[model samples]
Target: MRAAIHDERGVAAIEFGIMIPILSLMVVSVTDIGLAVFRKMQVEDAAQAGAQYAIIHGFDASGISSAVTSATNSTAVTASPGPVKFYGCPTGTGVSVVSAGTVCTGGAQAGTYATVSAQATYYTLINYQIIAVAYTYNAQSTTRLQ
Candidate 1:
């Protein structure tokens, strides 16, 4: 009836019902975002660990990847293939770095550096691939060799 439409009774209930889904979505989004950030930090730490390992023990692809995998301690993340890269550069002055190609062992100079990268894919809670809701995440670290 027109009087029922004009009346404000039960409006709060209707509003609450409408807001509930939006609030729930917000909560889920926040939770997912927090988890994504945590995962990103873990990946970054893994990359840093791998880079440090390479710096100390020289570049061993398997060892570096193992370090990454161990650091994360999660099966959801997979270390990228050929994650280690070596750069040779002049030390103690203006420097130019050149890629050591595929081979890295015994190729680094005093000022040379090693870079390690880690990557993983996180499946999103919502299925929205067009918005990049789920995609590959990458982390990288570089350390100068001693």
Candidate 2:
């Protein structure tokens, strides 16, 4: 009985067996998070691509939408809310929209601007108790056309 209690045989195996599940969980969690981050970047890039298209070719709703959708490899990405065209003046915070041909407070002329938005739904491989199974990612980009 004393020898049996003192036996170290199979201890490494037992430890490995206990650690296997933990290590697997950690690896899978990391992979899931990495994928989520990658998808978010794709969404952001899609929005930026749409804005760039509008800046280069002017704001065409259909063309901007197409650019957003085609900018990423993921088919889940979409151009949400389409594209918007407005006249705005550059401000300290951001673009301040006003009437066309309106002069800004700083004596700058209002410029035509386009905004593009992209959205995607990310579904996790595994659900966690604290985290949701599905997450929505949205991105927007704005650029001056003139």
Candidate 3:
């Protein structure tokens, strides 16, 4: 009876069996998070690509949208809210919209700017009580054309 109690045989197997589920769950969770982050980056890159297209090719709504969608391998990405053109003065952080003829506080005249946006939906492999299974990611880029 004492020998049976002290027996260490199969202990490693028992421990491994107990930890398998936990390790598997961790790996899956990490994979899901990594995929979500990568998709978000793709969305952001798509927006930037659209803006670049606008800067080089000028702002054609359909053209910008096409550029955004084609910028990424994922078909789920799209140009959402469409592209917009406005007059704005360049600021330290970003462009500040103003009248076409208006001069900015820094003495610079307002210039034409275009904004492009991209969006995508990400679905997780598993749903958790603390977080939703699906997430929406959006990104936007603005560039001065003139």
Candidate 4:
């Protein structure tokens, strides 16, 4: 009687098939996480830029935003990318400020100075999902003022 042997080709194919999907998934996950971090930074920087603009120029929130946009990615800040918005000034003080921009309005007699806040959103290709679903990521930013 001669010794019998079985083919290993099928086993190799099976292993390869299983590993390909897992490897692909791992690559995709890494890419997604990196993108998320990048976008979050963008939002924060944009907000800071907006506030900085107000601080130096006085009013004209748009001007600061424009500076930020020019410095960074404008598309990341806004879907349409219009002028930076300013709103809600204190009743007196005569310093132009926006209410929404102001974080805590009443620190020094209602118009002494205002704290400013700004926000920006970033988009990513990865859509987070749970149990077969999808989601969108939202990024935000804020700044402080006198």
Q: Identify the candidate with maximal TM-score.
A: 2
- Cα error, residue 14 of model 2, in Å, equals 1.2
lDDT of each: 0.74, 0.94, 0.95, 0.51
Instruction: Report the C-alpha lDDT of model 3 over 32-133, residue by residue, as the tens digit.
Output: 999999999999999999999999999899999999999999999999979999999887889888888998887878899999999999999988668998
For residue 36, give model 2's deviation from the true position in Å.
Answer: 1.0
| 77: Cα error in model 3, Å | 0.8
Give per-residue lDDT, candidate 3, residue 60.
94
lDDT string, candidate 4, 96-131, tens digits: 554543444555432333233334544444454642
- How far out, in Å, is residue 50 in model 3? 0.1
Runs in model 2 lying further than 4 Å from the true structure: none
Which residue ranges in model 1 land beyond 4 Å of their true spot?
1-8, 85-87, 90-96, 99-112, 128-130
RMSD (Cα, Å) for all candidates, in order, is: 5.3, 1.1, 1.3, 6.8
Query: How would the candidate models be sorted by TM-score, starting from the highest?
Result: 2, 3, 1, 4
lDDT of 1 by residue, 19-71 (tens): 99999988888888888888888888888889888878887889888888888
lDDT assessment of candidate 3: 0.95
Each model's TM-score? Answer: 0.73, 0.95, 0.94, 0.57
